[model samples]
Target: MSFKGEQHPGVQAPTPDSQGFRLNHTMLRIKDPEKALAFYTRVFGMQVMRRLDFDEMGFSLYFLAKLDENEQVPEEQGERTVWTFRQRGLLELTHNWGTETQADFAYHDGNAEPQGFGHICFSVPDLEAAEAWFDANEVEFVKRSDQGKMKDVVFVKDVDGYWIEVVQADRLSALGD
Candidate 1:
């Protein structure tokens, strides 16, 4: 069978390439991109790689990266972008001015316990130090236990009320062999 809007005569369909698939970045709609950017930069220490203004769309898009990989840093310079020393993952902040700019996604849902989408998680070195950093910044967290293999996890929220998990493990072996 032939696909729609195609002018090929007895040609085989092109197969999709799946050899090198990797996560590029994650995008999230934020009520306030400015506040979210600040929270991620100051608290999580993510670096803003590039922020482009879409005049047509009437919104601003911010691309942030974990500051550890110097090579992955965007070569673009100038703009209201901030970068920090966190090398875990990339966070994309989308700010929509005209429409409703908000989210109610939680990372986890356990048996009808006020569940939505849950949260994002990151591994840190010291739990005490990490908790202290958030505490100093007037951030609140809920320590999580009974996580099966992964215990001693702490739950925190960003400026936009997004859940974030902070996990600490002493040695590599502790994560399981």
Candidate 2:
């Protein structure tokens, strides 16, 4: 059966030649690195897999990932860079230097006006527990799971006002259909 639209005869999906093609990371610019790092690490339990500082460019890049409990990150910079690039589903936070000192500094969260980039999402094992944790931590909620028509999903705002969709991993199949 044709899905979405009719497919032309003798046409097939194009496949990449290489084997290890994976999404490296999604980057988000933040006003404060410390606040962004704290939220991703303390709230979501993601680790700082690697950090790259550009003193000349006046910026820093922090790559965070939800690694396995026992997975050890390489200590050396070169090894860690390779290891980080190998991992999938990474979040890269870019922090420009000296923005933290400005009281009115803010990044365009991509939710207002133009609204180009939507939001990043996380699938949790326990939706209720995650929601409870978010509430306990005083995270700003754009839409709670129970509040919206899609009752199984929740959207929360980060320190930089970026929307993060949180959903139950087990219910993903049902949600997809």
User: Least accurate stretch of 10 residues (summed lDDT) in model 2?
Assistant: 11-20
Candidate topping TM-score: 2
* lDDT per residue (tens digit) for residues 71-157 in model 1: 644354642233322333677788877434335533222213677566777778887788889889988665543344666677877
TM-score of 1: 0.65
All models, RMSD in angstroms: 10.3, 3.7
Each prediction's TM-score versus the true structure: 0.65, 0.89
Error of 1 at 146 (Å): 9.9
The per-residue C-alpha lDDT of model 2 at residue 21 equals 80
lDDT of 2: 0.91
Q: List, residue by residue over 1-177, the lDDT tens digit for candidate 2.
A: 456454789866646675568889999999989999999999999989889999999999999999887888889999999999988899999999999999998988899989889999999999999999999999999999889678889999999999999999777666643
What TM-score does candidate 2 reach?
0.89
Misplaced by over 4 Å in model 2 are 1-12, 17-19
